[model samples]
Target: MLIRVLFAVLVVVSLVLGYVGLAEYLATSAQYAHRPLDLLYYDLQLFVINSAPVSNGGPYPWPLEVSRFLTPAVTAYAVVEAARLLFASEIARLRARRRARHIIVCGDSLAARTLASHLDAEHRVVRVESARSPAPLIAAGLPRAARLYACADETAANIATVLAASQVERKVHAPLEIHAHVSDPELGDALRDRGWREGLEVDFFSLDGVAAKQVIAAEQPDGERLVVIGLSAFGRALLLELARRRTEPVEVTVVDPDGEAVVAELAARHPFFAVACHVSVVPVYQPEPGVHLVFVCHDDEERALRDGLNAAATVDATRGTVIVRMAELAGVGEMMVQHGQEDRLRFVGVLDMASVYLSERITDSLARAVHRRYVRAQRALGQDVRSNPSLVDWDDLPDTLRDANRASAGDIERKLELVGCRLVPSLEAAAFTFEPEEVERLAVAEHERWVAERRADGWRYGSRRDNERKLHPDLRPWSDLGEAERQKDRNVVLALPEILADAGYRIVRR
Candidate 1:
């Protein structure tokens, strides 16, 4: 708007100057340029061609040249400036359309929006709706996107976005990274399975899980009595994480109106709650001295803040800390850091949870990638990387292999998720054993997977184990394999649950 106004003023001033200059030249030289049509024609000719239609017999030649040049220059400048201002939005869109290797964030949910905010500083971000169809993706500049985040509120919508993005052929040479927001364990497993089977780079994460881990890590409530308000999804996840982290038995008193029902249901789903930690359910919060940490995680933002503040007020400021889950941290900043108050009050917003979740996602991806590289390098040297007992530290690997390993780790994790298996040493205790016949099928499935991976790497069917530096070079039919080889295969299949657990997944069933 300002550009248009400035140019308009310039155009009017130029025309007036041109008219006045031509009139003065005619008056001083007795050229009779005072006739209105003649004067207008002469001004127009000067502005267009920097030359008057008739010779300006003015006394000063320089003044005539200045008038001619100034009129045309100002008029051209006004036209160009007006066009640029009028089409500014369209020009920006065009530039974005041509850009590649940018991040595309799907959905308008709080988590998605928050995640985008963190990434916006380092990457170009485009937001799109979570539609089943691919039109929204294309409209959101998916073809140019290097990373796509599927963070819709609904699990189904997130899944759809990931699937749609996976099928998109990015303009860049590298595969597009698809990060999906997953709150449910089951949904995460399913998406991971799809990624493994198809070799797509899809990641699943939950802000609730991120929040739980972060709170537990910060509080470090080891063997300390704690009070947790609300038994919502976020609350249960936090309780479960706390129980997992605590080495010593700690009493956790859960408070809410329907605490009993929530705790009972959650305990059934998660066995650690019953075995590792002692927990009690109550209808209302009863603040006590010596409380190590108070987590007010009610779904209602205002109530949670109020409850946390009230609990902090009752507790001795030096011993206990109150943490409140709020939608917006700015609204109640004063309560978080009360002036002249000893009780340390902390506020955790959804955006904070989202930020933690994204950071974890990157960390997990990189770790898995590095591990994958380590295993692959071992395999190339004829070592059974999968069966190797030692766990390799990702940080120990060299920089050259880090990127390749990260990519391969994504593939390996996807495959691991697809088989509904993982390598947990405690998996046998966690999962029910299958029938002998089913166990045989599991071994055969692993054998088939091994064969497929070998074939993909250009290994042919062979049985010459002497010359070839192959760990399992005897590529004969599975039926012909010895009992020892078969047993090892079966052991690998049985370890699936533990492996899944290690990858932040809970294997509920064998």
Candidate 2:
């Protein structure tokens, strides 16, 4: 940007100098006496290196001499810049080789674009046309990149891209963090379950999953009675997130023409869906009284907006909020506000949500910090990475494990709400603490939340810990847990102040 500005300034300066120089030369010359317009025309020709200087066997005026050289230099620069633009990809590749710890985003998909946009402000972002192409990946400085995101439109393409990146990492013997976007829920789960290669650090994310988290965070809906008017991927994700956050089962009414099949598919994939939420399928949209929240998640933005507006009109302002899924913000919310529906209508854009997700995950966010704290605690108890798979660093942790940590971190707000407390940005570390009774109550709530999460993940109570069978004795109710197990939850409650403080937040009683 600065270079462009300087180039512009130089171009203008050369033009002005040429004009003034010509005017001065024409005024002082004895052999030539041209009109002002003629002089201006001659000055303009200097840029193409065809200007005739008005000199009668004597040295040209200083201004003319200066302009004569400056004009050609500016012309040369313009030529070079045009060539640079023509080969921008090659130039970017060459420049990328000199950059280290930069972010490399492959593909032109919306997810990739959003991630690049968010990271470019804080980090050097190198974009490549293809994720699976070795040439482009190498040109993008894959070996030098701090992180590589394979966000091609197709899941197979993204997978191939990451695999190619892994080969690059192996050849260079450099550690690279690889993130792949898997849109298919079942495929994503299967990949996560199969796990990445032992030595590679690969993370997978779904667009719907990230957007669902954003929607929930934005709305902060109570889990009393919710209506989801489309059992789309995003809708299912939202339900899963809600279940993960709430200890008690939420009553959700899914309104979709094919709600039965969609709900059945989700239930088959995740048995915990049935255990965590009391969901009822309905064929069509119906305005239900006493609903806490409603989400219009149709893939088509126009349909979503129309349905959302209708839902907003029927839903009582004081009772529920209606959310619409949009690809981008196009002033529909403002129009709703003009119609006096601002309090009830909200829009969640996919790009916006993806941007937030990338920003948080790419940095040392609160979620990563929570995982780090958990790892440290596990290590303090004499657990090693080999002995406990979850004892790995944030980068190496599986996506599911990472999601669990994120869910736990995300639940902080709900836990605060339980005790009439709230989190606000704070400058002081360890500046707040909960009372003894509050700690006990919160600890119990945390335990219940943990139980619900475990149950939702298909874990069951057993006499001993078994990761293979997904069984743990502590999976039972909080009351049934031993004092030692209860203390683990209490310790997390006790660490709330410091953890929140580290994330620049402080808990305050409402």
All candidates: TM-score:
0.60, 0.63
Query: What local distance difference test score does each model get?
Result: 0.65, 0.77
Stretches off by above 4 angstroms in model 1 are: 1-98, 129-131, 139-144, 170-173, 183-199, 334-342, 356-368, 375-510
Clashes of each: 10, 0
On the 0 to 100 scale, the lDDT of residue 49 in model 1 is 68
Candidate 1 structure quality by residue, lDDT tens digits, 1-510:
896687667666666666777666666555355687777777777657644434545454444556676777877876786898899867755766776656788888887777888877766787775757776677666766556788888988887887676666555433455777787633454556552323346767666656766777677777567888997667877888777766677788988888888778767977777776677888888878788788888778878777877887886667788877776653464554766443477777755666656745555543453464446556766776366533344433444345444443444444444445443222112444555675677678667666666556556755554324443454656888888878867765565444333333334333
Cα lDDT for residue 436, candidate 2: 91
For model 1 the local lDDT of residue 50 reads 41
Residue 194 lDDT in candidate 2: 56
Give me the displacement of residue 194 in model 1, in angstroms: 4.7
Query: So what's the TM-score on candidate 1?
Result: 0.60
**Whole-model alpha-carbon lDDT for candidate 1:** 0.65
